[model samples]
Target: MPLRASLRPGDTIGILGGGQLGRMLALAAAPLGLKTHIFCPDPQSPAFEVADAHTIADYEDQGALERFAETCDAVTYEFENVPAGTAAFLENRVVLRPGARALEISQDRLTEKQFLEAAGADVAPYRDIANEGDLFAALAAFGGQGVLKTRRFGYDGKGQVMIRAAEDTDTALERIGNAPAVLEALIPFDREMSVIVARDAAGTCGAFDVSENLHRNHILHTSTVPAGIGPALAETARAMAIRIAEAMDYVGVMGVELFVVPSPVGETVLVNEIAPRVHNSGHWTQDACLCDQFEQHIRAVAGWPLGTFERHSDAVMTNLIGDACDSWPDILRDPSARLHLYGKTESRPGRKMGHWNRITPHQAGNGSSGQKS
Candidate 1:
């Protein structure tokens, strides 16, 4: 069942969601002598520009999904929001990595928290919110402070509301359109970090270095390598990521978002969320390590042996959100900066246009200290 035997040169891989991640995956595949076919509803998808072939049709269109599945040796998605029906259709035909169960678990907030906890991971206290009354009781249980997030379709601060006081609950449910939700106690985490782990067909696992993340307006701003955490804690994070992957029989690169919270005994690492596919936090690995995350993912899905991801230098990867990409000309002037721009024609606030990584030769005894350029 390990689809490893027939992946020769020029095999076509089908990718769902024609976005920047898909574009990066296609770019990575070229060196391995692979071709990519992109499938998405958007005709103007940026990935369409780089992929070897593409199908522009809605995910619900059975005819389109059938045609797309026939052309690829393996199918993987760039985003977790991929529809369950579409993934199932592809799985019955071609090979699908990090399969439908991974998408199903990550697509719902309540399910994700439960899955992580069952996999022996620490998670924040939470309760399902099916109605306004549930929200009131759950928020009160967390001492009048909790974040209410919709169980489905929530990302980048969307479909969520922060309740800081009793008075703020008046229209909290209305804000998210009264969708099924979950209320989580907000932990005053010391630092936000993430670990990207790859699990191949043989169940072998390897994790990239931790990234100490910084967010602005609920969007990731930068990820600095050699996270300020100690080595032992970093290992704990890596082990946690591997456990989660094995629990789901996951194949491909997955990102595990984590929170470092201080406790009386020591710093408690909590599972913040899981990304079923390649992630934003792992962008730093692209320049810092020889086997970047995008390529690692391609290798895993293609059933090739995973590569080493050890970094030779410290790196700071900053996401160019919205109009921030407008300064590309200025940013590219730095002789050492590596710039990556997603080929999107229009830019709006909070849109992730691209990113750039600045690396310095590894400094002895000062790996964790870094800032974005």
Candidate 2:
């Protein structure tokens, strides 16, 4: 049977994948009078603690999936890696926000680049590296130094291999295990930034202030608002994000990651990637904006009017990964800090256990831009 004509406050929202993102989404839904039911393969998933209900089942379990569908007024996934087949299965019974097509494009690096280019957005120069021969050809074509990233299942520097001229090309390919991948020319960028924008079915769109991102070991470590790239470049990035969201006819939040490059044509931007759901970079919005990205996404997906994008202060957000969680007491003591813990069971190295944001009166020169060196 089809989903009810429209969701009411008491209606349940079903979420796929249980992680910190889902936890935040669940928290956002409650005040709006909606309850959440979480489903994930991991029985120890952290998100289950706060959700109104949960189901521990593999993504492919048809029986469990049908039950979940029957319970939910609509479905939205926390992570993009939800299997395409699973999405297709659930969409038959429930309304899946952001839609399967958006998920399909974002889950694969190659297809995402193709889609951006087709949409007339600027992107890094890339070529498919299907095998060793293809890698060699791409290396030759792009000259020294390119990034070889897996087409699927890559995040936070995993599944990515850097091809420097000094490194043995064959060995690098072996390290990557000959996965289907895309090789992109390494960008010489002044800074890396992202735009988190949301759109609804009514064609209304809103963009959070552009944020400058700093990475450590290819994982995002900190993000700050008022990226200091000046108004023109900021507007350029936001426009790019709006175009991508509208092109997909998306009905939720999306992130557009880009490189701020300096060139003879003056500084310009290149699209690095797109995230079809709430993004890590926009975490600062929790303290700085009137409506956080999570709530904005919920509003859009529920067919409600989009919220205003009013940012009250400039803020800096830092991820508390692994041993970083040990500083929780210190973080709590700081009056300027707002902390969020994921309720994760253990703190393994490099795991994203939690994060904290510091809201201050917008200082001008605080190491604001550039990819982490």
True-structure lDDT of candidate 1: 0.88
Taking the tens digit of each residue's C-alpha lDDT, what string does model 2 give over 75-124? 99888998999999988888899899998999999999999998889998
Q: Which residues of candidate 2, in runs, are more than 4 Å off?
A: 1-5, 362-373
Model 1 C-alpha lDDT per residue in residues 1-373, reported as the tens digit of each score:
5444336779988899899999999999889999999998999899888889999999889999999988999989999998999889888888898799999999999999999999999998999999988987888789999988999999899999998987778888889998999998989999999989998877788888889999999999999988898877887888898899989889899999999999998997999999999999998888888888899899888888788877878889999999999889987898778899999889998889999999888767653321110
Clashing pairs in 2: none
Shift in Å, residue 141, candidate 1? 1.8
Model 2 residue 237 CA deviation (Å) reads 0.3
lDDT of 2 at 86: 92
TM-score of 1: 0.96
Clashes of 1: 0
